[model samples]
Target: MSVSDTIVRWRYRAVPDHLLGEILTKNWIDNAIPLLFLAAVVVAFGSVIPDFYSASNVAILLRQWGEFSLLVLGLTIVMVAGGIDLSVGSTFALGNIVALALLNVAGWPLPAVIVATLAAGAAVGLVNGLLVGYLRLRAFLTTLVTLIIVRAVVDMLLLKYSVKIAGAFVDSDAWYFLGEGSILGIPFSVVVAIVVAVTLHLVLSRTRLGWHVLAVGGSRRSAHNVGIPVRRVICATYVVSGTLAALAGLLFASRLGGAGADTGLGLEIAALTAAVVGGNSLGGGRGSAAKAIIGSVTVLLMVNSLVRLGVPSGANSLLLGLVLLAAVAIDVRWLKNRHKVLSKVYVSPTYAALPAAPPTDGDSPYAVNDRLRSVELIGLGDIDGPEDVILDADDNLYAGNRTGDIVRFLAPDYTEHEVYAHVGGRPLGMAIARDGSLLCCIGGMGLYRVAQDRSIEKLTDETNRSWFSVVDDSRLKLADDLDITADGRIFFSEATVRYEMHEWPVDCLESRGNGRIICFDPAAGTTRTVLRNLVFPNGICMAHDGQSFMFAETWACRVSRYYYDGPKKGTVEPVIPDLPGYPDNINRASDGTYWLAIVGMRTPSLDLALGMPGFRKRMARRIAPDEWLYANINTGCIVRFDESGRIIETLWDLGGENHPMITSMREHKGYLYIGGITNNRIGRLKLNDADPSWTGPKSYWGRT
Candidate 1:
């Protein structure tokens, strides 16, 4: 067999992309892997050493894990916040020493001793926080220094005082009960560890503080720009880490009945190893307290099993090192390849045969014209991917660009342009509200409004997620286009639910029904889904009568109409069933007709490939993005249609030299404002026969 054939055969046997995505994205998967590994360890050890599952041994295991779990919990938080606390072991040792000294030597009250020990640990964390957060020191280096200093101080104290908790204190029932006592068959220490883990888990997953921690860790610069108080978040993580480590030290001292210089030796490595193995990323922003507990248990189990199997204590270090290295490598690889893996699952559509060529005769109804060829170029090389353009009542032109800016050009000459507002997502379609606020559909961010003073307010960003979705679909994935109704309701289209805005082409390959139509009422301050499960819904525009709206589903190559009032209220039907190319934005023409922008011409090869689902899936996995057969978006045309969806006139940029991938067009006065996704300049086509003062905003809201 050929190499290509062999590769295909191999891929067929591999895990499918959709299944892999489902498995990887599941929350239970993280804990499940460790749990399975732990089970395997238990079974293997139990077979060789019969007493492995004995009640006494299990109790011993829980006791050991309890103290170790405290350190792991703190480290997990630090790691999740995109920082580390290497001084945890030292802090742990210090807590034990301080507690013992205060309790035995100074004869202090138990509560006071516990308080002082925790305070001492917090002091160390405070120093680390100041250096790393306020001073902007590297977490690794700063924590390493703190670890050394703390460890040195611990050693000096041990040498100078030779301090140890008295045996009499250990004999006290009150003190001994804390470490060895049992409540309803669960050890007190184990109970404490369980409470701490559960509490931290809730905090990390549910609380605002947890969200900020994750946000800061996910992208520190992004967090700072969004006003998350990056320094404070980082600082707080260190303090929590230090305090938890001290608590763990106190537990260790109480259990062992004394404090020693080597009490927490090598404990830092164990804590870090557990956290990493628990599926927490060392790079930050993704870990949990449950993961830490599981990791700690796994490590403890491995060590215990090794001891029972006649393995030397020295081999434990080597085994831990290997495991840590493997876990880190696997996690990094999974994260890096997640997108590529997801892309592979998209099964391309296939046709029974090649699609027929579209006729483009000059004599035909869909003719080629030079209406845009000699147009004036505005914002050339300054605007990036201005998908749609609109004009306000005062004749100011507004266009949403790929760089997340809504640019405005002062009219008459249209020479001066400025950024009206920055929405931080690729802004696709735009419209002017009756009050003159600019409403825009920002891809991946949802709908937003920019007021007269350039201040942006988010109108809506959520929708009712489908039950079939594996990820949270409530957040708008791609808010493609929108239009306002006469009754002050805003109608919009979400391009796709499965993929993000950047992966638009990928969703096209899948041809899945992942798009939806939504409506927002400004009066009620509520947003709701108007329609669901559309095929890449792109552009939206209100009907001339204001009782209905028209939307274009780009992948399906069709335009549909939905009526909320009149005879066809709450009904949907196709306006144009099949098109010559992929449709983008549809806007009102000066003469009451509508103009639609065809972004790209349909091709036979893409249609044929889309028909064969198996072949398309295999191709997606084997080929690179540039090599994949895609919808022909390199050349485009603008076609005018009446209320009945019959084509009247067509304007083409055949060579795509002047205007390629035309996405939007608006008729204003005697000129047509054209926007292209791939063009640097906005095209202006002059219409000699059209009215001179009829702008787009006036045409919609009309001199009110």
Candidate 2:
């Protein structure tokens, strides 16, 4: 009776018989750029190399990349979580040596040896994670130390003996099978690596675990505020890194038929290079295992080809270094931030069912750069919310602040300081006065000025000549950045009229482009719109060549050059196309090199939202008061370009501790000064011993 009743009851449940269907429906592959690139690289290699397409050679290649692939996959997780383990290569070598020693010298069982080796790797990673995640160490510095010490330890141990361990636990047959044999014509090692890659890829792209990692990496502080256990997650990432390295060590030991010193030599650099090259941002957040795998294979193939062509390892390293530098320089950091305009693909009519005016080109600007190259922290002593700053004719520095003071840095060393004037408002953008005073764009109270003796005077409260908003609502305008022109006019950007400083995203998603480039004239004591209906117009810079100037449209992800004195006084041209991130304050380079500060970047989701105004507004409106969808601004940094829009270099401030939230990057004389709208102090740094090529603290680009 019991057996029949049990069978009858179980027949209906059967673990929900439609599990496969659910999996098929929910599987991730909608935007598999990494896999596509990976397949493309393999195919390209096959076409070029004679044996690459052959099954046997392909199997071998898979095995080769497979060993490194584990490390790459592990790195993907950590990178997604916004951390890295440069000590992995050392720990990898450690695993190999330890495993070999365990099996051969200590005569341990294979299972116990494998476990011990993995434990050693985990321990190494733990040290890195504890210092970086828990103890608040810089990921780069902490792992950098481990990279040196771990490599030194390995080198000392290996060079001291030229040691070799011949494992006697697993017979030669098993080793051969692992290294060279295949089941169903597929190398077991490659298969193992594939399974791992697929599993991790799914985890990152589909599961909550991947989402959590990305959330944490994208904004650690935000994630922590949301109770994401950021430190634990970051530390766990390193532990995963260690596990993968140990596994890779197992595979490496087999491949060589024994363990040696070079088992994982220089692997840390390779892993880092692969992660970054594959587009795992060095700035943290915005990465995937699939992408990392593709990147790893691509790097591996590139090296293989170079080696085939008689390039020394040193030369290859040099080439790799250049590639890594160039890739980061391109601001892949911003690829995750751009919203693509819909020209009729991927956007459905349901998402576009707005009963409103149809959009024309530039009718609206985007909600949020091409990319942030790097941030050079220029110290300005202490000032609360040092929002915006500029230089004067004497090379003396002046920065406005929420401290309600126009603070002046009187000397080169920044030691001589003074609270020049108290404006009694949240001062934002500021400029040098024609009367040798300070003109500041104070927040909430419009633009104001300070006298030589520190008297504050209000310039103008509102504009009357031109409407800068999409709906002609004057209250929507908020005075932001300002620049003084040669004709005694002040051209300023109202960041958003609708949303003050706090509700910026709503202004962004509304996509109304409700900002403007307004010109204020001292002679007339009036203001007019030079250009209206611009999105998040930020960073005003007059061209040093005397023809025109440029301004960064932050939400739109491009910098536009506007001519002032030419026949094409209203024409704007793109200085950089497809910025990876959102641009912020841009200032003219003293040496003709323009520095554009990218606040955030373009993301696929944001791109899709661009085509669907309703979707964007819906998301924007539905966002919880405490929740926000910020671009990966904190990751990576600002970019520098020549006069002709050529990329010169990048300034990266990964992990954003001292120089976090770099909204404005100003280069003065020999030092580059950085100001974040959110921070209290101005950060400073020396630029590779200072570029003597640049000059500054002048009348700003052709102004008399």
Candidate 3:
């Protein structure tokens, strides 16, 4: 390799620029900004404030953060359900007074006091839920009214029993421990808070109810349309919020040993600020418990730092309000444009230089001809997009239809057809096994089989995961074609793991080696990747030797051979180094040769652009996908080649009438059947001087 070319290859292909795009596409990316903000706050405050990192100060901060996070967690759930609970502050105050009264005045045991406090908070929440969710009232106004009424009730009760509660005292050691306790050198409240945080995080992220909550938050109408019981989900969110807030209030009462009229004043504002600032979208459907915790710590530090700086309480509130405004603004704008930002960076193209095309003009074997013009049609308008066609012992013609079914054309006249089996994914390639079962490769799914009884069974859906791939590649993304060895080992091609079947054109633009070959052993019931980093590997055909196979790397415009169990085992060598067009499927011919389907022809412009990946990258980012340059797939042909990879002859539909793009061709009984991925019918052309009784099944299993 030349020095400049090597540098370019290393710069684009060696460095992992695609990892940034993969990371950006993940859900956890929402936590990035909040985490950065938390880090900045800690560093800024810890440096400016005297003794900020002292053990005593750190302990106090943790105590406040532990209780405050509960309220933030509650509000996050309500916000995620597309609602808000302004009454949380009032509910907290009521829980505090109820806990104090039950413990000090009523002399109730700790468990009873805790339960009563929780029940009192739940009662208020139930009222809010009914008013907003069931009655269909505006959430903001209803919660605002509840906040006022609940706060008034707490004040009246506090006034009535303030003297008695202050004079009375609980003598239990457990009560004292609940208020001010340590467990294994950690504050008891911090441990409890961590446990609650982890439990709720799992519930919110991994459970069905959590998904329902997010669905309702994202769009209530859509959720209702999908039969999600929208009103109940919204109502349940409020109950969850109220219950968590009450828990926080109980912890606060234990720590402080008392309650007052101002016990939970403006608590709702602080919690909401923390939730939004921590990256929970105020617009709903986008938040997590970890984000809430990060926000709580940041707010707690900011508030405590201001207090230590002797800032007035009124100014502190004002600053907090401004911070909330800024946070809401950031949340709204960031969520709106995240996809746009991702679109710009996600398609990281790499350098790819395809070899110059071979000559296909007059006298050349690959020269275009009109041999396929007057071909016979099978299942003309009855089928759609038969990407591959095959034949069984009885000469029943089988082809994969675009509607995810294997369509069988009765052989006698090729007129009648029936749905042989429903695979649910686009079936691309087929091979007849020795036992009469039909093995097929399903796009977006994995290898499967249609048994003799017409029952469908999955062979394998996953393989060993790559250790360094940023995206999970264990699950087959696009299984394009398959060929089984004599030992029942099926080798298949996954065309591209980075894009689905529909987005395959985009893969051509990058021309990256995102495809691989996987082998499945029915004996051991295991699947493993046999070859890696091929550019759009499409077809898998066992060679006549039965020890090796040839695969078409479509985007690379080449065919290669891999030996599975011979002296050349575990090695790959080029078979057809360069072809005039893009290759798709390869099948054995009757004369011990192979037939390759050229799905598309290459152009000089596309070939030139492959060497200049920057142009392709800019074109992808600046233009509509339809306007991007693509291979000339609308007109293709079939080529016959020998075992030595020499093109002997070619067949073409000159006027593009019978089959415009040939993806697969099977030779059976002196005729070649052609199929296309975008055509409505299968084509059959006569092949003179070929074995008259030859059949694909007989060629492999020897006339069973």
Candidate 4:
């Protein structure tokens, strides 16, 4: 075997058939594991340790977890924004000392002391933010220095004062209640912590600031390019962290009735551990406030249990260190293998082995022809991936390019091209509307319309999600092709709702129903699903009767017909039962037939692999993309079909020298225009018998 063959064999293997449930719930498991472990620890310790779950001990647990919870919440925000603040522990210590000094030494009012303490924390955080965000300093180093400096200064102040506040009664009752008082059998501190956690959870999950933070963390460069306030978002996260840490310190000092130098000594590490153990990614953009709470509870439970079991203080530290290391390692591995785990759960459809290619003799229907051999290449080096091409009444050729642009080649020599519009996504099948607007289906984005002034407008990017989908499926995942009806209704196909546009091949590997057909009615201003649970629905074209439309399910290797008007309205039937290759865009031909572009041919190896879902799953998880058994798209052919689903003729580019992977084909004025997703140029094939003056818009709407 060749080196490539050996590599392919090693990558392909069988996966367990019964692991679908595990794959679907992997994310929930990641979040719930820490909570479950904490529960187990509680049960184990409570059974042996005396009064471990007693009322008094439970209250103590709540108070301790509450204090740590505050710090963890702050750390979560900073971490989610892709930054780290090592000075939170120091800030907590400093805030406590400042509060005590203001209340006891300066003789300030309790409220003023509390505000000033929190302000001090915010100020420290501002400095860290300025250094990291504005000055572009490394977050770790900058916060580390701040931690040392703040800790030393706070410790010096505490040593110098060595004073305690002496008031127990009416004067400080309100202040005392904040930290030590109880409400409805729960500690006041615990109540406060719950409130803060709930509020921050809502803020992080529902607000624009939360999105900005996640975006910046996911990719700073991308966030900047999209005009997000990356630096400001990062800076604000640090400020929130400092403020919360200070509040935690105030609660600690109030509950203990005194401030100590080592009050928050190891709090930074503890908070970090809680965040990570709760499934928050340290690398950023993938954590939540709720996770922080669960993590904090888990960490506190372990420490409390150890202390109750007579474990030495040093041993407690060692245990925590080990736990932190384990948690980080688990988090990193989970993040790295998440996609693989998901792939394991996908169940692919079984496909029969593809028969040998039909004889290419001159008398055979599948005879090889050189129709595309002498094709002229347009936009040779300028355009990339013109997946679909169309023409207007003036015979101006238009094609969607890979760079999110729709380029138009003016008539008369058809050489000069100009960028018609930038759709901000890969534009696919296009249709000319009655009002002269261009309707385009963008890959990642949804169906859009390009106006006469070259302005792009989103018609609709969402449809009714399937009832079984737990995910928010309102947004279109991959809008592949679209066709406009005479009555202003638009029919489109979402290739696969499960995967993004770039992961199109992954959808084929799964071979499960992840696609659907949708109809957008401009008159009603609504978009609704016409058919559901389709397997890779692709090209769409209106029928000659204008009462129905034909759409292709690429992975299923068939074209289906759906009638919107007439006797078969609200029903769908197969147009073409099978094809030799994966069909892409289907356009109406001048002779009232349809032209279907086969993007890829079926290979024996790929056909056999499809029959074994286990092998496909294993390949998805283990093999690199370049080595995967992708559909054979290097060779292609365009076939014409009549209304009865009978093949009229086949045009092949056997060598693919000029036109490879034909995704779309449009017949205009005696010429067939072809486009491909990976090709760098547009192809033109002249036809001797077709009308020389007919254009797409003229055929559909007649001359204005």
Candidate 5:
């Protein structure tokens, strides 16, 4: 190899640059900036103030964090449900006054005081929920009104009972413990805060209510269309916010043992800043409990650090306003542009240099001929994009189309056809199981079965994830083909994990080893990857010996055999090391040979680009997707080969008028049935010297 070729190969193929792009595409990446900022602030504060990390000061900080975190968590839930609660601060103050009045002026029991304080907060929340959710009032204006009303109520109560509350004192040990006691070296309030945080996290992540909140926040019209109780979810979120804010106020009253006009003042603004800075979206539907806690801690630390630095109160407010402004700007821009950035970097091209294609021009074994030119067309114009064809025991032909329907034609005459099943995903390769059920590979979905009753069931959509992979490889992204073994194990191929079905062209451009072979055992109910890092593994056919199967790597233009059972198990060996065109689905022939479909032919221009990864990468980045160079899939032909990998003959539609770009072919009842991914019909060519009684099902399962 030349020096340039070696360097290109090592840089593009060996180095895992694509993983960086994959990491950027993950949702967790949104929290990275906030976490980093939090770390930087803590370091800065600790350096400036020696006492910031002292044990006594740290305990004081934790006590403050406990109450502040609850307020932020409540707001986070409300925002996630596509609403806001500006009344949280006012409700907190109201709860404090109500708790003090019940304890000192009314002389109620401690439990009654707690209950009354909570009810006051809930009542405020109910008004907001009813106005915004049921009456269709704007959330911002409704909550603002409630904030004013609740604050006014708190001021009135404080004016009426300020003297009596200051003099009265509770002497009970339980009351003192609730206020300033420690549990296991942690503050009593902090322990309660941690428990509440964990419970809310579970509810948000693992419950149906959380899913409903996200759905409603994402799109209320869509949520309602899907039968979600949108208004009720919104109302419930406000109620949750109110209850949590009240709880925080109760904790504060316990710790402080007093109330004033400025109690809970500007608390709402601080909570909003913390939630937004922590990485929770103000636009809603995309946040978590962790985000709320992180934001709260970061903001709380900064505020305390400013006070310790002796910064003027007005200047502190100015600095906080600036920080909130910066956080909001970053959040809005990141939310708007993340997907755009992902699209630009996600399609990472890599080096791919296939061996020189076999000779097909002259008297070589792979020489093309027009043997398929005069083949009869079946269901012509009545079907579209029949990627693969199969037949049942009665010789009834079934073909999957681009519209996600499996169409079936009656036997013998081949005139009448009907939609066999509506699978709802583009179905590719198919096989008839011994139990008379039809197993199919759906493009975006995984392996599925169409039973004798025509009911559809998913076999498996995931496998064990690869340990070294940056992207999650467990979910089946593009299941391509399959063939069953003698022991009821189904061996299949996944064309590419990084791209979806419509993105196959992008996979072709990359030409990387993004494919794998998988095995699904019926008895054990397990699916696993048996082979990894193959180049667009497409076609799968159980070898005649039953111990192995032949799979085609499309981009590499070759076929290989994988031993799944017996002595040679877990081994892979090349069957057809080179081909003139891109190989797709492979099927057993009636004469014990195999039929391979050349989905696309190779060209010198494309071959040159594969060796130059730099050129493809530039093209992908600079050129519009529709204008970029694409593989020539408009013209394809079928090749017949024996078990020894010797090409016996090649067939083509030289006129390109029928069966253009063949993707699959099946032999049944003396005829070879052809299907194409881009063609509008099925082609049937009479095999001159084939077994007339042979059918695919009969060959695999034997006579019933």
Candidate 6:
């Protein structure tokens, strides 16, 4: 080992002891997952329908996204700061009604018009905020009362004071400029909304206001203990929320050529849906503006596209209901289940042509919580063809890429440096051997060993498949996962023998039972199948006692255990089952827990496919021997499970720039490491609340 690396490891130990959960929640892998998922939705639709991206369509989409994002932004701030405003839609309606009443009856100028509108909105926000913050009322109950009263009052005022508001403020050039005009080729409203997005981003990310908001949301008692002036921040968020709602109202009125009783009608549903879909945590302390916008765009796109696609008028409400239901599900569920399975994505321009397999370590348990959240994604940009990840004795990481070599990085930072070893083929998983050498698993090319001096030697090109009863198939079907046992046996799984990794789900749908769990004792150097008749086994991890290990069965969405000793020996038991996403790998977390990685999610499309066995059988029969169909696994993400198989937390990528797909996760020391087979580089993140202090891949096991 290099003297510099040794010194750095010593320094990490010298630092203060950090909390495991604190580190786990740090989102160490990549942050841009949500946006990418939204983008993928956009791209998928745009590609499928020509009118989806036309100029007129784009304009409408931007306008709709901007307006809904404004409302969602308002709500997310309150939500992340630990509060909810059920009266947002009513407040929004009242903003327009009040402004229209003033402009029509009193002939108020543009300035007064806006002030009056905001003032009215703020008044409602004040009542709601005071009742909840100072009077200690339940937020939902208080806001519900306010929502009823405000909606009624707004309706009454709109009816009682109806005048031609166009001349005064609604139809004036000034109002039009603010509502629909452009600045630098970008719509003025879009620019305004984006500016608000950037400002909120800064406030939530860098300022004391952001910290206090988080404190207030995380715990009211802790916020009080920290002297955070929780009530003030709470009130401020609502007031800001009201102001923005009024701004949206004003724009809504102008864009529609004046307001009416229906102004901002049903906005609460759309706005709240956007906030939740954007990945905001209703429990607070973890929402981002980026997510709000992405969620808003996604909502608007689906709604608008369905309308444009000539969906039956009767079905429109039903479809909208589904998306809304999904958004609400994403938000409310994440509130209680942030630590559960997370789904996300990766997108990069350079990776446009790469074919990706869901990141799997051939037996690692992968979780599949497809529910969206309100957190910002972190992305790992350009790098080489990266594949696998490994951790040293001290929990530092070493990984591999398509360049036929293994590399090293410091966890937390995950900054890449000099190549550690040069193998002769495409390395996927790197494991530390008992002899102090590194074992490398190469896709399509068998296994090999790299000495301390970086010299490489072949380990085994063939694993026995005699049990399969297939003739003339003498090559190791596929070497996908890796683990070291106390007895020096290498335990791994062949993802599929019937098809290569890319066409795995076909085997999944076929339920072919072709996967096998194999082991190779270094002393004898012969690989043998310990368990056959499995379907797409992915990750491999030994139990702490060293007598048994667990592996992921991807096709069936379960984890199976193989005992190397004891009376239960040679028998397999279901460790975890019915995962929401495709199971990728299972790793031993240093915290005495097991972290499972779920590669893709249970999309409705796949659900349909699963329900129809004949359709799959027929498709397989028609396809050419070498042909493959890409499913939506690219839109899913990763997660972690405990030793008892109880879901603990989720780490997701929404499926784009941050990470298109996360197939593997290895936790080591204080950070987490990530890998995707088709990705050009691996990713690293610090888990703010993760428990494992050390002894992991930094737990980035799949490096691929």
| Cα deviation of 174, candidate 4, in Å | 2.7
Ranking by lDDT: 5, 3, 4, 1, 2, 6
Q: CA lDDT of 272 in candidate 3?
A: 88
Cα lDDT, all candidates? 0.82, 0.68, 0.89, 0.83, 0.89, 0.68
The list of candidate 6 runs beyond 4 A from truth reads 1-33, 47-50, 166-171, 312-317, 327-704
Tell me the deviation in Å of residue 158 in model 2: 2.8
Each prediction's total of clashing residue pairs, residues at least 3 apart in sequence or on different chains, is 6, 39, 1, 0, 0, 83
Write one digit per residue (lDDT tens) for candidate 3, span 14-46: 787668878888888888888898899889988
My TM-score estimates for the predictions, one after another, are 0.78, 0.45, 0.96, 0.83, 0.97, 0.45
- TM for candidate 3 is 0.96
The pairs that clash in candidate 5 are none
Give model 2's TM-score versus the native structure.
Answer: 0.45
lDDT of 1 by residue, 124-150 (tens): 999999999989999899998999999
RMSD of 5: 1.7
Best by TM-score: 5
Over 4 Å off, model 3: 1-7
Tens-place lDDT digits, model 5, residues 191-305: 8778878987888889999999998888899999999998889888888889888888888888888999999998888888899999988888888888888899999999999
Displacement of residue 688 (Cα, Å) in model 5 is 0.7
